[model samples]
Target: MKKLSLLILSLGVLFSCQSASSKTEPENNPEIKMEENKTMQQDVTKKKNRIVVFETTMGKIKAELFEDKAPITTNNFITLTEKGYYNNLIFHRVIPNFMIQGGCPEGTGRGGPGYAIKDEFGPGLKHDKAGILSMANAGPNTGGSQFFITTVPTPWLDGKHAIFGQVIEGLDVVLKISEVERNKMDRPLKDVIMTKVYIVNE
Candidate 1:
């Protein structure tokens, strides 16, 4: 009887230690730790990005500004939108299967908000797909209120332009605008105006 009691006590301690070890194994696992870190980064990115809605004459377009990736360019765009600077602005330049350029208050692609901002480029940001929102600049570091939304991947403009945001909804509307009739300068034959622009903190 004494021997049996001692054996039972030993087994209990062994099982208890095994259970404790298993509980802590995941906390020490490198793979699990990496996954946890990745999830944290994703949450941070979600909090940083801002949603913007563009109510154009053609249709409504929704976009997400990559504030973390392009702080300067995103700030400039958000500031302008908050100030109603994009209201009534026309998509001055349009090309089928290419891009639609706008945000020139002058409606002639020669105006700005009385200032220019430095260019921002990142490895993760690129004109790799349609609906990419990028700064329209004449040369390096000349970005201002002018911007464009690509209707197709424009890899050539990757480092040349600052990618600030991407259209999440209303891409068909962008495609429609791109197919509109334009003149010699690629300006839309009839105005495709941005009736209203707003920002959502989420």
Candidate 2:
């Protein structure tokens, strides 16, 4: 009986040591570990989202384009940008330290892409600061080629418009444009033309 009990304890200890050894072994194959990590990181980054680069005549302006959250607004913007629709349009309205409106075919802040788009608004975005670029519209569900860049917070415009992107560079140029002399309605004394529009990889 004593011999049997000792043998059982030895077997239990051996099994326990084997389990502990297995616990110490690495599950991942070291040869492919780095490659797998890189692939996963890329997948996550691809879904992490990116912004659009608006190479303007004034300067290069980077904008965080909204796509996942604002599909319609983003699609419209992408369509226009891809087609070079914004080239040569002037920022017709310049309210100093307030907002700069454009996207008018006539560069008069009264034109569009000959069609309107539905408005998409929600949380996590606001017009409560400067350098914010948003879609310009006549009324609800009437947004099109028109868009504006804010120079100051316009809280009143929030929830009533769709913010497609925001300036990430050359805001000083925006400020300079804002300082342009204005007419009675705060429109620019002269046109702040966007001579060209091109894309850059984000």
Candidate 3:
């Protein structure tokens, strides 16, 4: 009878220890860890890139500013955008197979924010492809608020213009704007207005 009692107590202690061990075991689920890592990576990527959207009369054009490559130019653009500087402005110049130019407050491609930002020419930043966003200037170091987005690759403008961004979305809208009717001065016959322009920090 004593032997039976001893066996029962031993079995109880063993089961208790097994339960405690299982409860104390750390959770090392691989799927949960992978999901956590992916989320963190996405957050970091969003912080690194800055996007801007142009809600035009035609359609929305989204571009990613080259902040890492052209800090000064991007900063100037962000500041102006935050201040609604490009709102209600007209895309004065539209050249098919070339580019669409805008950001002129005068709606005649002759005005700016009353001050100029020094040209920022990052290495390899060139008008080498369609959708390239570049600063427009009459001469070197003369860029102010005026800018342009190319509809086709313009290699000749390299080194003479400050290429600060590229259209990531709405390239079709840019192309549509470029196809608009224009006068001899390249000014669009019907104004392609920028109804609103804003920045997206992602």
- The model with the greater lDDT, 2 or 3, is 3
The residue-by-residue lDDT of candidate 1 on 1-202, one tens digit each, is 9999999999999999999998877456798889999999998866778898999999999999988888889989999999999988999999998999999988999999988899899659989999999999999999999999999999999899999999999999999999999999999889999999999976
lDDT, each prediction: 0.92, 0.79, 0.93
Candidate 1 residue 133 C-alpha distance from true site, Å: 0.4
lDDT of 2 by residue, 1-202 (tens): 9999999999999999999999999897886998989999988777644566655456666677766678788888778877989888888887776877777888777778888888898558899888888988878999998888898899999889898777877778888887888889777776677777655546
In candidate 2, clashing pairs total: 0
What is the number of backbone collisions in each predicted candidate, taken in the order shown? 0, 0, 0
**TM-score: the better of candidates 1 and 2:** 2
Please list the residue runs of candidate 3 whose C-alpha ends up more than 4 Å from where it truly belongs after superposition: 1-47
- Residue 4 error for model 1, in Å? 34
User: Which stretches of candidate 2 lie above 4 Å from their native place?
Assistant: 1-27, 48-50, 53-58
TM-score of 1: 0.77
